[model samples]
Structures are given as C-alpha cells and as structure tokens.
Target chain A: MSDALPGPTLSDEPILRVEDLKVHFPITKGIVIQRKVATVKAVDGVSFTIRRGETLGLVGESGSGKSTTGLAVLRMLTPTAGRIVFEGQDIAPHRGAELLAVRRRMQMVYQDPYGSLNPRMTIRSIVGEPLAVHGLDGDKKATREKVAALIASVGLLPDMADRYPHEFSGGQRQRIGIARSLALEPSLLIADEPVSALDVSIQAQVINLFMDLQERLGLTYLFIAHDLAVVRHISTRIAVMYLGRIVEIADRDDLYRNPLHPYTEALMAAVPVADPEVEARRPRAVISGEVPSALRPPPGCSFHTRCPRAMAVCKTEQPFLRKISPERAVACHLHTS
Target chain B: MTRPLLEVNNLTTRFRTERGTVAAVDGVSFQVAPGETLAIVGESGSGKSVTALSVLRLIPNPPGRIESGEILFDGVNLVKLDDPGIRAVRGNKIAMIFQEPMSSLNPALTVGLQVAEPINVHRGTPWAKAYEAATELIGRVRIADAASRLNSYPHQYSGGMRQRVMIAMALACAPRLIIADEPTTALDVTVQAQILDLLKEVTRETGSSLILITHDLGVVARYADRVAVMYGGRIVEVAPARDLYARPQHPYTLGLMASVPRLDGGGGRRLMPIEGQPPDLASLPPGCSFGPRCRSIIPQCRTERPELIQVADRHAKACFANV
Candidate 1:
C-alpha cells in the first residue's frame, strides 16, 4: 500500500507552526467601563504544524475550537498568547503592515456560501477584491482575465463573473469563494467547514476541486470540519481537537484505522456507515455527556467529563501530547509513558 | 397480513414561482407497509421533502399545490379530502417530524404544551390530561427526566434533545404513520444513531409505518427497509435497502453510493465524485437528469427519459443501460 502512494516525508521545517495558540474572549461585568469577569477560552494552548504542500485536517464536534484554531492561524482572530511562525518568520510580533503582509500569504475560505459572499458584489469584483487590495490593480483587464481564469479553474463557467452571488446556487457561490481565496495565490489555505454547507452530492465536487487546486498550485490546506467522512477523504494528516486543545494528531489513515485517544475512538465509532451490515457490526462507544462549556472547561482533560474511559488521573493531571506510535501523537493518560 | 399503512400513487407536487410553474415532485410512487420503514433519498431540489409535505396536504396553496396524485392511507385517498377531512387525519391518523427541530418546534411554547397540543386539538382532551400524556410521550422517546423537561421550552433543549422532543410530539398521538423528514441530518453522529434507534424502537412498539426522508444513503442503510432514490423531482430507483446498497441499478443511485466517503473499507483512494452538479430544476434537460453526470451514459440516454422498470423482486431502476 505504501509503495503505490508513498506517504509525504515529515520534515522538521514546517511551512506554518502554531505553538500554545490561545484565543480567549473576555466576559465583561459592569455597565460602565466593563470589568473583565471571566474569559471564554475558545482555543487554549493548541499546537500543531502544517508542512508545505500537506493537508492538515482539524476535526471535532461544534465548539471544539477547530474553527477558532483555523481563524487564529489566518490571524483573523487576535490570539491572546502564542507563537505563529509562518514560512520562516514569527508573526506574533508582526502588526499593522507586517501582519497585513503575513495575512496575504494565508487566506481563508469561510463555511457558509450564503453568508460569506456579499449579495451586492458581482462574482468578478468579489474575486478581484483581494488582487485590488494587494496593490495589483495596475492592469484592470489582466486582473479581470485572471479572475475569470480563477473562476474557470474552480469548475465554474467563465461568464459567471458577471452574475451576482444571489443568482448562483450554494455550490456555485462556494466556487466563487474558492476563486476569491486563490486570487492572491496564497501559500496557505484555511477552509473552515467549507463543504458542510453544501449537499452531500455537491460536497464531493467541492472536495475534488480542493484536491485538484492543491495539486495544481502546490497549496497547503488546513481543512477544518466536523464531518469525519469528508475530512478523511481530503486530509493528509488529521488533528483531533476537543474543547480547546488538540487531543490527537496522526496521519489520516493511521488515525482512522487505529485511533489511540478515547475521544477519537468515540468520534470514529460515532460516524455512520453506508452499509447496514457494517453499521450493525461496528461497536458504538457512546460518550455519556455533552461537551463542557469553553468558558470554564474541565481542569485537567476537557474531554474527561464525556470520556468513557475517564480515570482518576484524568481528572487531576492534564495529559500532554506524547508519541503513542511513530505516526501518532495522543494526549491521554492511557497512552502516556 | 394487515393492509399497507400508506400508499402514495403518481404523486405530483408543483409550485408557482416568479419565473414560472415548477414541478417539484413529478410522478412519484411508493408505499410503506405497517411497522415498516421507507426512506426517500435525494439531493436538494429532488422533491423528497415536497412529497412528504404533499402526503399531509401541507403544501401552502397560494404558491405550492399538489397538482395531481393520490395519497391513499388505509385505502382512502388523502388528496380528495377537504381541509377539515385532512385535518382530522393529520394528527390523529398520521404525524410528521420535520428536519430542523429548532425550527419545527414552537419556541414560545413549553415542550410539554407543544407535545400535548396535538392530543388537545385532535382528541379534544383536557389540557391537564393532554399535558400528562405529553410527559409520558417524552419518556417514551427516552428523554431523561421527562417530568422536568416538560416545563422547559424548545430553546432550553440541546439539538439532540429537541429532536427527541419532536419525535415525542410526533408519536404522542400514536399515529398510524410517522413521516420523518431528514430527522437525523441535523444531529451529531452518536445522537443520530440514538434518534434512529429510538424511532425504530418506538415504531416497532406501536406497529406504525415510517416514511424517512433524507439525502444520506448511510442513514437509509441503517434505518430503512425500502429505499427510493430521487433525481430531478423523479424517483430514479426504488428497492429494498440491502439490495439497493449492494447492487444499485440506476446510474444516479450508483453515482450517489460511489460518491459518498464510506465509513467502512476503502484504503485511501480518493472518492469517485460525480462529475457535474445537480441539474437546474427550473431548466431541466431534455432526457435523464443524471445523464450529464453518469459515467456509463449512452447516446440513447440523452434522447429519452427512462421509466422505472422492475429489475428484481422489489428493486426498480430508471435507466436503459442497466435494465
């Protein structure tokens, strides 16, 4: 199996590296001059790296901090603390123009097609906005041609550039969004639940488009989604985020085939199978409780409340991400040395 | 054997749009025997929801209408009935669970009141009696601490819980047939399994037929006894669940099965995605709607739309090449 499609070698040098990334929103108290009462830690001390030209899938249920982590990676949200090393430079200290330059290299494709695209803007202008913003508006005709080509590249009609976003369907609008993200030729693309909004049939088309674009343009993708099926289809490596931290990280096949983390095992078991016989045979590991609130997550392991195999140690001591196998890293007392 | 609970014959639903009249459900036909589960599978605009709505005669008349069809429930055609006649049967004889519990359930009303309202309206039972019935119904659907949850509003319940409440509400009257429209689509996986299991169990206990409408083949495989695959407002394939999954005779059904990322098997090859998007319902092609995306489409497929032909005992496919 390895001979047919060799796994991409893991390199020490990563295109984008996030260490202890935290995004916390303050909950205020008074009417006048609000005092910070508590913080909702959307993403807390999460760390992972995306190698050049590799797809890293961030997967979890809603409010698992997967989307927050993706937004933090793009600098769309201000991280309270952490180091974001993009390419070779550290972006934590970068502000204003420096941050703007770094943002140009990292683009985001939002989940909702209806909400993301402006109804007022035509497809051409929507795609061309990034080009115009990046100080590439010198030749309007060439830019328009490029926008049309980008539209075509994402499997949309070239003439769709003239139509308004409302004129197109959900799938077509998503294609426009993809085109807009690619207008600047960004090195890193963070797609946050991009295909979740579309129909199951349309999801395949868009996922294929992502793969084709990645191969054709040598793009690195940090694909964030709750849909494990879609995640397994596109991702090279997968990071399982729970509450506000990554619980597991491994190659896609390795993670799917043999998940070490109990949280991951439960999640995989929960995925519905297409075949009835297989679904009946598949043992379901039902997590007992709902995910704890991020405002005040469980002290040690955020998943301990819902973890089926939660132990006494899982309550008091936080588990660090340690290598369970050569291909997998799991943060659980069960796997800890 | 008992008579089939619900039999829909040549059901056609249409809506008057700003552009023109649109036929959403075009000549669809199927049946759900007592205690059986029938799944109507389709993508967006395939009229799966419309067909379900038409059965209850809930299609808004100003724009939407059941142009032609016979929805026979226990040998009586629901299409021929007046508003009052249909109203008598809607909650008393048949009930429906919508896709989104958050939207379907009345947010202003308490969960108990919402579930009991059907009993109040249909049976003309006292409010207190109906409310007691509602609490009992909640417990029947497996909600923990049903008595406490009865006073809670729909917003207070989580997505899965709200869906359970919806199921509880639908089953409160113990209707002959329960029409569940993508009941589990909005739920997480574990919750989905639980909901599906609950529905299956409750239906079994009551001996009620279920019409499960969803786009997911996976959900159908788990819950459905019979499956109907819809494409461009038409039933492209209809078969038993196991038969359809094993040997999909229609090109559209086969494409849908192949396109989905399987939870079992498949060692890392990229999913074989259907080439093109779904056809524009307003401007459908001359022949088969799936012809554009079908891998093995022949020249004849472009000229004539194939009618469903029986390929096996209970399996049918609407494709010339496969038949």
Candidate 2:
C-alpha cells in the first residue's frame, strides 16, 4: 500500500529554512544578587528545512532540543542566534505586528492535551480563538459555524463545540487541538508530540487524521516526537537530534535502513519490536550511561560520552553536519571525512 | 513445567465516582510463572495499571476497591491478607515500579536513602548496611558511579537515571515478583530498551517473575514470555508472545497490532487505525466494552458479555466470533 505513494523528493525552494538556531535559558543562583551560574542550552546551532507539503519528523530522546528547535522556528522563544526564513522571507527579524502576521501562516499543536486547552473556554472559543485573534470573521455565528465544520473535519462531532475540554477524552481533545490548529488554514503546522499523550490505538487515528488533513489542505508539518515507530509512520524525512543539535538527517527509509551516526544507530536499536521473531533476530546496540545534562553539554559531540564507537577525535573535535550521501546528512566524525 | 509464581483469577476492581461504581478491572485473569515476563498490553483506562495496583492493595480506598477475585502469590491469597500481611509482601515479596520515576521517587530524599528505605522497611537492616546494598543495586541496574549518584536527589537524576533508581529500589529486597507499570513510557526509545534489557537480565538472574504493564506491543514482543491484551477493564486475549502477535484471536488485539507502526513497514502509508475511541469507563455499554470499536463485532457481542474461553493450550480469548 505504501509503495503506491511517491517517495519524498527534496524541493529547490523550502517553505521554512532554519540555520544555526540557538536557544539558551539563563540559570541563576544565590539569594543576595542572583548571579548567573550557567546556561541551559536547549537548542544550539541546529539547522534544518521544511518544504511545502512535506512532513519532517524531528526525533530524539528527552532534552534533545527537538521541541526547543520547533519553538525557535515559530519564534515562540527568541533565538539567541539563527536565521528562520519562511516562504523566502526572513521572519526571525520581525517583531510585534510583523511577527504576528507571519504567525498567521504557521501554526503549532502542543504536546499536552490536559494542559494546553483552557478549562474556561468551550470548544467553540478554543478553536475559534485564532480566528478571533486574527479578526478574520466579524460575526460570531459565522465563526461558530466555521469552528463546527473544522471540528467535524477532524472526525469530531459538530455538537461538541459547546462542551469543555474536560468533557472530552484524551484522543478527542487532541482532535479538537488539531481542529484548532487547522482553523486558520495555515500552510505550516508544527505538531510537538501531538499524539504522544494519546493511546496507541488512538495515536494511529490522530496520525492518519494529520495525513488526511495534509492531503486535503496541502499543509506541511514539523512533527516532533521521541518515538521512532511513530515518526516512521508519518514522516517523509527524519532529523535525529541529541542534546541541543541535529546529529543526522535523511529520508525516512535511508535513516532507518542505513543510519550512519552512532546516536541514530543507538536510537534505532532501542526501538522495541512487536513481532517476537523480528525482535529476536535484531541485534540490539544498547548504549551505556545516561544522557548528560543539557546545562553542561559535553565538550564536543554531546553524545560522545554515551557513544559506543566514541574515539579521541569525538571528545575534542565537534563534527560538522556534512552530506554523506546525496540525501543523507550526518554530524559524526566517522562521516565527516 | 514449573508452577506459576503469581496467579490472578477472575480479578475485578471497581472505583466509586460521583457518576457510579465503574468496574475498572472486570474478571481479568492471568498468571506469571517464576522467572517469566508477563505483559499486560492496553491503552489508558484499559485497567492494566489498576490490575497491577490491586495485587499490592495500592488502589485508593473509599473511591476504589477490589470487589472480587483472588491474587495468589506463592500459594498465598494476597487478597485475603491483612494490612500488615500485605505490607510485608509489598516490598519484600512483591515490588513495583511506577510509570513516572520523577513522581514515584521521593523528591526530598537522596537516591540512596529512597532505594535503601525499601530494604530497611522490609528487612529492618541497619541504615548503613541498607545504603550499601542500595548502591550495589544501583550498579546492578547500570547506573554509573553508583557511590556518587547515591547522594543525589531525585530531581538531580535524569529521567532515565531516575527510572534506573526506581528499578534499583524495587529490586532492593530481591522480591519474588516485580510489577512495573509503564516504567519506560516516560523514557526515550534508547533508554527504554536499556531499561527493558536491565529488567530482563536482573529478573533472569534472580529468578523473579515480572509483570510488565504497558501499552506498547513492541515491548511485549521483545521481553514478555506471555502477553495479555486488555481493553475496557477486561482481558480480551492472553497467549504466548509469539502466538498472540502472529495470530491474535481477539478482534481488539488484532486492531491494536495493526495500528502500531512497524519499523520494517514501508513509509508514507496510513496506519490501519482502530475506527472509534476506547469505551468510557463511567458509562460502559451493556455487552462487550470493545463492541463499539471492533470491526468483527456481531449482534451477539453487543448483547452478551463473552466469557474468556480457552482457544488453544494455555491460550484464552474473550471473544465468541474470533475463537
């Protein structure tokens, strides 16, 4: 069934292009003056691009800067340094009203359904907030009708517009969130672990909904998640991140079939298989030690300390993101040469 | 064949809410043999966690109660045991690892103290001796620099490391059975695999039975000897790991299997998602809880609750049509 779909081809012009993105939160200590102790480098020197109608899956362990990168792209958090060119325009330099205008074309669906949705707001207000904020429609009746239609489009009942978030189940709430993201008819959608909070059975539903929406609306996606299985299901291209930087990026099949980066290999090895025979046959490369603190990321490759194939060069020389194959890019010293 | 270490027979747990008493675990039955891993696979509200919590009598009283069933551990009925008896068995004979290690471990206490507390509480060993044993257990779980890490608080440890600490604490007393409830849900794939491997290796070394409560079918195939598919508070299907995945008898089980995206599966294809949502526990339907979502559901399934009947040797499914 999957073979019928065309392979994801790279476009000459990307809808969103990010270069050397960095987001650092200041850390302070002591009571007297609150001196700066250090910085938590959530995202550092990460570069990627999302073409129109393309789904780019950003995968990594927790604190891998995937979510931070997403936020930085959306300009939710002011980046310390980077370029975010959306639709051939540098949107990073924009501020206030200018940034708001750019945001109309880009939308984000958050991770937590329980927390993201406002308890005070009904489904009508929650989904219509974007429309209200943008002042798209004047009449409340017209907005409510549009919201209802959007809800129905996402497989939710139109009558649910009157209900609160608490009344809906986790999966239903996520659909509502998706509907809210789609309310503005944005070209780019950044879904940060959109289906992570959902059940396995329901996750597939949400994922398929996203695909269906993409096909129908011609929307692009920056899908962020830690689950490789899920990323494999929805994404065309995948970018592997580790502690503040993208370690590898490639076509979904290329990355899964022949992952070059050590971290990528380790991540793939860690995914549990549902088939007993397949699991038994696969040789697992269990990386030793825990992911180091993002506050004090390793001196060189952030994953060097935990990398099974770590060498002296890995500790001193921070590898640059270089194209290993035409479609595959990796940042390990082994592939740098 | 060896006798099973833990046997759960017709276990049914209920929770009294403002709406009504909802049966969270309805007549669920499964057994875990010594040194074997039994996985309970289900989505949220499927009662997989509740079933595990019932074994330890950890279900919140007043609101939640085990209405009926027998939890037989080492030939002793845990359900019948008094507070002290259950307490005695909780950490010493049966240990548990919660879903979120960050919340499960004490934020105030150091990792060493938290892990050692189990040993001290159950065995009454000296604090110093218990602390030493805790450090050893930490090392056993593959937490590097165990001595230095022991002094660190739960907040100081990473998610994966904290989970390792939780595992260490659970194994502190060398319990006969360990009930891990979604222990790897909060962890990354790499960390989750490491934790699973550690669990499997530790359990194998100690000859302890493991009840891994999780929704991930992949984890079950990798580590579990037996798999029990739960839905709407009932065991819809239970079979050997390989057999269940290859030929799932229950429609719900098959749906779950098909829904999960395989690593080897081709790209760009939409996953075969289960049509509808999981049933609401508060207002469950008359017959089968999964009838609304089941593709193969019949009129009989909607009208009558199916009994878990043996479909094969040591394999049972709670479905009329599939069997």
Candidate 3:
C-alpha cells in the first residue's frame, strides 16, 4: 500500500495554486511577417489557490477573463506568464508526454453541452474513450461495466448508454458530459459555465449534482461563471474578475455580505433578486458604463473607469492584491490606504 | 375602470411544420393598462415570444400564422386590420424592440437615418425636422453626443449602445405600446441594469405601456408591475408582481421560484428543483401542461386542462391542485 504512493505527500498542500497568471492574446497585422499591434490581456496577474475538495468560483462578465483563466490553468491556452502548480508540481512548462500524464489528473467540463458531445458516438463510447485512450481498457466487459457505473453516478440510467447525444434533453446531455469528464477520475475539475445553457428549472438539478459529486468523490473544482447567485450556491470561496484582473477574492458568505471592491459591490447590486421585497429594499446603485476592452484596459486600476468610488490615486497608480483578512484579498485603493 | 391599452383575448398562434401544426401560443389571454408594465415570463418553447410577435402581426405567413384571436388596441381589433392599416399602426402606435439589436438594425444605414425613417413614414415629417426629432430620441435614451453619433454605423457602436439605438427607434414615433422581447439579455449584468432602468424611465416619461417578454425571474420581479407565467403555450398563472413573488399560486410558479437561486438567499440552502424535462410543444400532454412536473398534482390535472380563474384580486391560477 505504501509503494502505491511514493512522494512527499502533505495533507495541507493545496490541490491547485495559480500565481500571477497572465494570458495575453496578441493582435497582429499583415498575413506575412505579422507584427504585433496590441495585446489583449485576457487574464492578467491573477492568483488563487484551491484546497483539496474545495470549489473556487471565478466570476465575471464578458471580456473579464474568467474563461481565459480556466483555459490557462488546463493548459488548453498557453499562458503568457505565470505558474500553474497542480498538486505541488508546476506543470506550466510541461508538454507532450509530461503534460499528458499531468492532464490525466485534471479535466475540464465545457459550457455548451450540445456542442461538446460527439454526435456520431454513443453515450457509452463517449464516456469510455478516455479510459481506452489511457490504456485502461483491459477487456470488453470491464470497460462496459465502468461506463455503466459512470453513467449511473450522474443519475442517468445505465441503459441510456446505447443512445446518441441528440436523443437526450439539454439537462440530460449536460449530465452525460459530466459523466464523461468523471471517467478519468480526475482530482480537479474546471467547470466553465456548465449549467448556463440549460433551462432555468433544470439548472438547479445540475448544480445539485455537482455538489453531490464533489462530496462523494472528494474532488476540487474551479467553477467559472458570470452569474453571482449560481456561483454563491456552490463555491467555498470566490474570486471576482474585472477587465482581466482579479479585483477581489474572499470566502463565499463574507464576500456577498461585505464586498470590499467597488466592482464586486456593483456586480452584486446589479443582480436583481427574485424576491420583490428584497428588490424594493435594496439600493439602486447600478454602476454606469460598459466594460473597457482588454486590448486597452484603463490605466492604473482596470476598474477605475467604472468604479463608483474612484479616487485620483485609482486612476494613476495600480492597486495590488493585498490580504486584508485571513480569508480575504482585495485590490482597491480605498481599502489599501 | 379605464379600458386596457392593449387587450389580447384567447390568442392562438400556430406554426405549420413537417410533423404537424403545432400551437405555439394556445388560447393565451392578458391585458396591459396605460403606462403599466406587464412581463410575460417563460422558458424556451413556452410561447412567450410567439405571443409578442402575434400581437404585432410579425409572424411569417407561410409557416406561421395567428389562427384565432382578438388583439384590441384602443378599441380597434388589430387582428382584423388590413395590410396598410396594420402598417400604419406599426411604428406609429405600436413598436417592437427585438432581442438582437445587431440583426435588427441595418449596417448600411446611419443611426440618425434609421431612427428618423419611422417619423418620415408615419407622420411624413421633413427630413430636417425628422433628423432633429431623432437626435432628441437618441438623447432621451441616454446616448451622449446624440447628434454626432447619428452618422455612426451599427458596427461602430458597442452592444449596449446598439441596444440603446434600438430603443430610440422604437420610441421615435412615441408609440402608445412598446413590446421589448428580452432587450437586455445580450448585455452584461451592470449594462443590463442600466438598459432596463433607461427603458423604465423613458416609458414612464412617455406614458407608454410596455410588454416585457423574458425568462429571467429576477428581471421580472424588479421591473414588472404585473407578471403572467406561461408554460407549454398557455398562461398558467397571472398576478401582480408583489403578490406573485409573495405567494405563487400555481404549482409551476411555485416550483420555478424555488428552483432559482436568489442573490439574497444566503448560502447552503438546498434548491428544490422541479423534476422532469420542459414540455415538448410538438407533442404536449393530454391535460395540464405542468401535470407531469407538478409536486401537488391532483387527479383532475391529468384528466382535464384547467383554465385560469381569479382566486384573488388581480391574481389568477390555472391549476386544480391546492398549492
């Protein structure tokens, strides 16, 4: 049993740690000898950590780099600069066989269930492909049993494995996607807006399924979404991004109750509560203006342009992500000074 | 009481498909008083958007048509109007703001020209006067430097700005009724708040009745004076916004409210999601549309469809269960 696990294994070590991660997409001109005109800093200097079995939600609107950060962590998109340490190993520079071995422990669940599944393959084949690809397909009967168990884990019937993707509903398709991602038995899952495409009534079912899977499997998650309410439901801690930079990161309940950054406050206030009484009692402090382009983000603090409480310093000097409390970090001049 | 600004009675809209004639909006009825905001809330294939298109007669004739209904606007039945009569009403008395602003506006034309064209056609105003009016309309929707932006194309403007231009065109003639179908769904949350606030403000100033069709329960709670919950092409429940949120009568409404995770609902609360898939409009069930999904389903619900009946003042529900 001890031979199966040979390394300096620490119980308190984070399952994943991302430090100063930057994913800049270059805009070039000309077809031949293209010259870089500008750089879109999609994920700039973002940092966070996820303990084993904890869900860290990354939330932001369009062009905020929430999706880019998730991709960079998975190495699907190369990071311009940073460290993505998974289980104490910096796999940022790994490639080919090294990267493939590391990727076996990390999986990503996409946002669009309709486009993610293969139309030509059956549900059993789609879920079992990963097992076969990793040389785990020992025999026909064993592989079929494994696929059936995975399908049943997501609350879908085992017999549905023979059906195609199009035959199932949107919610059922999303469950199948989850089942396929879990086939590898990865320790960390990066779910990017996994339930946004489903119907309102079905979104809750998927969310509950995610929580259930996490508890039963002891899986860590990096949940990226734009909806604050949905993020709050499943996250242990949250990181709020704006203009490709993380403006605030705190515990789930603390962040919602007392948001330090102006952008965080504005984002929360903008989400209309379902209860009319709560809506009436809440303040109408909707921040004006749209998100600035990532190619030319506002100088100093990226959110200063739309910050309701922006001061002179916020426009000229950048704010660093500094720890204010044990479980909170904020990038705002108002709190720094 | 004063007559409703727009009254739709038993409006049934169907589309001819390869499978069969599918009733997209089945016997739906609702009303909107002057200056009031009525939000029709439903998910995809619930017929909320079809009802809005039916009101304006924008449904394509070959594949889609209004089978039977009475759309009365200021005492005149719009469903019975001739082609030219309907054209006169459109943009002059009732204007529609579509969900996608990029597709709705022409890229070849300037913002000023598009906004002013309705004024030119409806009232036959001179080009100079119409341009001036268009500038005012754009400014009313909170677009800065409206005169300067008139020459800008739709491609030059951002998504939020493009939507503002769509709203300006809808208000060019000061239409009595404005039907906006998910106007802010494409924009971000903060931008969505700004757009909805501007819409409410401009409509209030003009005293125009607004029919907002959307699937977001949160948006409906904040902006709607009255709400009509739709399911499987029928109006399952109707009530004042406050009452509906306070006490949702229908089982579907109750399930929907419970399913959504609220911003203020703290953390760790388990969501009670309604079981079963959304109804298939092509092959709907025999009786109640929500019977299979209802938590408190009664025997009568599976045998016969229920009609919306007034259970309280301004509150109605179409369910046989005592929920």
Instruction: Give TM-score values for chain A, per-prediction.
Output: 0.95, 0.94, 0.96
What TM-score results for chain B when candidate 2 is compared with the true chain B? 0.97
Worst 10-residue lDDT window, candidate 2 chain A = A1-10
Better model by lDDT: candidate 2 vs candidate 3: 3
Reference interface contacts recovered per candidate? 0.48, 0.83, 0.74
DockQ values for all predictions?
Answer: 0.53, 0.79, 0.83
TM-score of chain A of 2: 0.94
Candidate 1 has what TM-score? 0.94
| All candidates in order of lDDT, best leading | 3, 2, 1
* Candidate 3 structure quality by residue, lDDT tens digits, B1-323: 67899999999999999989999999999999999999999989999999999999999998999999899999899999999999999988999998899999999999999999999999999999999999999998889999999999999999999999999999999999999999988889999999999999989999999999998999999999999999999999999999999999998999899889887786778888989899988888889989999889888988899999999999999998888
lDDT of 1 by residue, B1-323 (tens): 46778888888998999878888998888888888899999999999999999999999987998988799999999999988999999877899998799999888999999999999999999999999999899998878899998999988988888988988888878899999998888876767867888888999999999999988877888778999999899999999888888888887787787778875555356666677778777887878878888888899889998888889998888888942
Candidate that beats the other on TM-score, 1 or 2, i.e. the better one:
2
**Candidate ranking (TM-score, best to worst):** 3, 2, 1
| CAPRI tier of model 2 | medium
Model 2, TM vs. native: 0.95
> TM-score, chain B only, every model?
0.96, 0.97, 0.99
How well does candidate 3 match the true structure in TM-score terms?
A: 0.98
Worst ten-residue run, lDDT, model 3 chain B? Answer: B261-270
Off by over 4 Å in 2: A1-11, A29-35, A139-144
Q: Which candidate gets the maximum DockQ versus the true structure?
A: 3
